[model samples]
Target: MSLINRLSTRSDDFLATLRKLLAFDASQDESIERTSADILKDIQARGDDALLEYTRRFDQVEAASVAALEIPRGEWLAALEALPGEQRQALDSAASRVRGYHERQRSETWTYTEADGTVLGQKISPLDRVGLYVPGGKAAYPSSVLMNAIPAKVAGVAEVIMVTPTPKGTRNPIVLAAAAIAGVDRVWTIGGAQAIGALAYGTASIAAVDKIVGPGNAYVAAAKRRVFGTVGIDMIAGPSEILVICDGSTPADWIAMDLFSQAEHDELAQAILLCPDAAYLDEVEAAIARLLPAMPRADIIRASLSRRGALILVRDLNEACAMANEIAPEHLEISTEDAGKWAEKIRHAGAIFMGRYSSEALGDYCAGPNHVLPTSRTARFSSPLGVYDFQKRSSLIQVSQAGAQTLGRIASTLAHGEGLQAHAASAQYRIKPD
Candidate 1:
């Protein structure tokens, strides 16, 4: 049996089959949701005491107080200094590139005076503080620490408080090193839904943050979802996805590994290819089979490919682009000779990797764009995480006396038409002194 599903646009049920392939049941684990809700409630009510209790139970860390869970700034700095020379150099370079890219994304306040001396514009300012949740233990992601915290800092957020689970109280030094490199304000040895609750509701030790951004387990995701109204949250991302639109010009082996890049994320992650060449698809499949044996994550890649991955044969390049726009993949790679031409037709991808040399893995690490992309088909409506995610906008309106004379009458008429008597009266009061 072939390891991956094969489909062609010539089939009568192609659209239907494509839709099925794209479908992901985001059904929340009710057990996890209920558990998360209970934890969040307990944290909100008990604050520090509940946090300490959960920390001990879940993370196996017995802290005398919630404050003790904090990994001091000096520790993060020491971790950075203690890293191997090559590792430190690479970390610094990636951080510099990410910071440089995000700096360009910074939004500034602006206003313009109208002919009537009235001023209207928008004021842009960063959130005061942001909570960054880093998954720790064996699943520690130092790159996540850089991706989440760096953008917040670039947006001018005053503080970035990091919370990571330390199983058996064993801290991941690389994760701590990332915190220092990203300029995170504080580091706390905490995790799970309780951490989300503390960041959302505020504990004596854990100061509430304006927003929270990071990936987490089911409990953490649920807590972030429930506490969304209280504090802003980056989207609850679904499984990662990568869609390659190839013209068969790129190396078959390169394309095969590109598919594995996203597939290795988890069993649920999707990796698909849309090409007009069937022979090339066969070649890529053969490459995948030959390369599978040597991959460290071969099992995960195989399971993912068997379950959701697809080798799709489109009618032509135009049709492939159309299908790509419909799929709206988190990562879209156009590995063709004129990749830029196809990229111009693409409207919906979280990130587009143009040309054969531009691999998706680079974007995940040091490509200078955010790796925190919209997963599943959410790229259709959402975007990659960036500096804008940490900034809030406020409208600025300044009415001159003369301008108010004209605006008040308009406001009064609109308010009266809506039967808001108090609103109309207030507007009329401004229009007429009496």
Candidate 2:
């Protein structure tokens, strides 16, 4: 409905406001530990039976067998043909851009030869298999398919699997078409914790995967957290968030529309604006008032704005940057002059959109960057899911007789310092004698 005031709070008061803005219920327990434990036990104990039961109960669909789970190859092809030419062309272009961008992120194996001829390097290779979890049912976002799968494909992963819920016992053709464009190896009609379990443990129908990725509901997030140790996960994503910084140069209508983009996601989603002048804040607020009632999800956006969104009036752009760093939102837009100059001051954020033309939605769809980003201030430590998520690195070291003698003594000393006798002996043996 309106931008909540965050400027009145003291710096110490900021944390509490931030927690409220982030929709963090200090009293609320996530129940991830409990839910994941049960899901894991059921999948481990009964495998396909457990998965099928959960799928029926939660998803309201019967996937009787693994063969029935996969979207047929012919159907996938047909889905592409079924789409309007414009839509198909869009997917193609987006896929190509995503692929080209991710291709640059591909890690390469590198080795260095020491003066003593000791070769040391890191081997970068894609995982044998990867599982992508795309949230379906309420919405169909072909962009998500492109965002999640292209990175793995670029990383040279052997297999890229996809799982989405089909509530009507049918898949969206656009989803299938996008999957084809992104080079998906398999697509399954399973979702929620059960889909995660299927990917982690490998049921009769779903193969075990090295990693699982994509955005989902709380159950899905909990499921990913549950399966983390057994397999790698992208990140435990929180609700959507956006932070826009402007110096009154951009139109208030455009700014308000951008803020609404994130607010419409969910009531818990945050849409904040950090500006130097109160007049700019007023203009944006007026724009929001004019625009909110027209949108389909106005109620959701209004709730989000009232509960979590903010319009902070700072003294200068520097102060705005400081506040933004404090928030560390999932999406940060620099709509000010010299957008690149302000970007350098941003120490925390999931993704930074610079300049007037660079909209957050572009990054969500066609931009080269992955849209799956860390939220709820986790961006301070985490990052967007990318080529690295689908790959593993192993250190490689080779030592000659002389090199061994030089390094082994140091290794033995370190082992001894740490009270590891066997470790010391193992290093000592190579250089101690013939």
Candidate 3:
């Protein structure tokens, strides 16, 4: 698990390596698209039969009917109560923190009036219902439940529906507790693309949702992309990524461990260190070697690092910032003196941690900001999931005759410039002559 760098024949060789590491082009083949399309079409046309077949094929769950897929409300509460008091309390506390943080993000309809009799404003309204996809594989992630559902709850979404894959009769008690804490209206023991399909196109038991949000495997991501137009999706998330720009302030072990935190996500996950000082880079490499063996997921981390990770030898902090922006990593940690000052140059990161003390893990769970963020350089144009994801904004416009006349003529002239006669006439209807 040492830092291995392939010889770069040219100055931009790193870019090609990065593209492979990020797996940016892995899904370019239309197989997933074609397959997902077929599955979606089947579910769309055949309805329950397609859903049941896919559920059995993918999830290996033998559900005779849609009613069997639905997780009973009593079972959910019983599972939560089944957890010992402290674990339940922890889930409650995490949910409370998440709810309180997102409550501040709550928006209200607002309007503004001008002396010229023009009214312009926006109406903020929560979605009627939203479906959250919680992954059931690996270990239980109660934090994810809090992260995904609490914001929708804070945004005042009427019904927050959760769907998680529970094979046969294995339900995660902590996950249920977290869902209960986050005010989920319903829970379904279904997962994978089938669950997404059910939410996108309402089944006999599961209702259609206005928005679907959560993290999942490749199939889940592809399904989200397929169902995007049917309902809103948070973002087409990619593999996890982290970029650390250090100025020899933080410990090598601390830096190494932080990099591994994201690397263990998958082989495609990335952890890059952009530092000007070569000495610090060497120390960090040693630290990575020393720490990698101790990690439980060392094999995964090793594959991730060998494939995607890098210790870039930038010329200066500016160069580091340039590389960081080019990558637009999901998590950017500035571990230099006056980290905030260095962070000002960062314009394209999902989230910025502006000090040595702030690790990426804090942002993953307890941090108020969403851990669900854009990845694979999408941060250049995207943002983290938030109240904004669950809420919609409708622009409000009002104009009196005089106000209309003042603006209408200008709009008409512009529309005419574009050879849009109908648009010009629509605006011309309100224009007045002196």
RMSD of each: 1.2, 2.2, 2.8
lDDT of 2: 0.86
Global lDDT scores for all candidate models: 0.93, 0.86, 0.84
Per-residue lDDT for 1-36 in model 2, tens only? 334555533366766766666666523245865786
Clashes of each: 0, 0, 0
What is the Cα-based lDDT of residue 432 in candidate 3? 72
lDDT of 1: 0.93
Clashes of 3: 0
Tell me the spans in candidate 2 whose CA falls farther than 4 Å from its real position. Answer: 1-3, 6-19, 26-36, 432-434
lDDT: the better of candidates 1 and 2: 1
- By the TM-score metric, which is better: model 2 or model 3? 2
Residue-wise lDDT of candidate 3 within 1-434, one digit each (tens)?
44544322135776776566556664634777677777777777777787888778876788898777777788778888899988877777667777778888888999999889899999999999999999884458888888999999889899999999876557788888888878899988878777888899987667899999988777788889989999999988778899999998699999999999999988778888888888888898888888889899999999988887888787789888888888899999999899888889999999999898999998887767888888888998999888888899999999878788878988888999999999989988877766
Poorest stretch of ten by lDDT in candidate 3: 1-10
* lDDT, ranked from best to worst: 1, 2, 3
Error of 1 at 99 (Å): 0.5
Please list all clashing residue pairs in model 2, or write none if there are none: none
TM-score, one value per model = 0.98, 0.94, 0.91
lDDT (10s digit) by residue, model 1, range 1-434:
56999999999998898889889999898999999999999999999999999999998999999878889889989999999999999889999989999999999999999999999999999999999999988886888988999999999999999999999989999999999999998999999999999999999888999998999988998999999999999999889899999998789999999999999989999999999999999999999999999999999999999989999999899999999999999999998888889899999999999999999999988889999999777888999999999999999999988788889999988998999989988877767475
Q: Candidate 3 regions off by >4 Å?
A: 1-3, 6-23, 28-31, 408-434
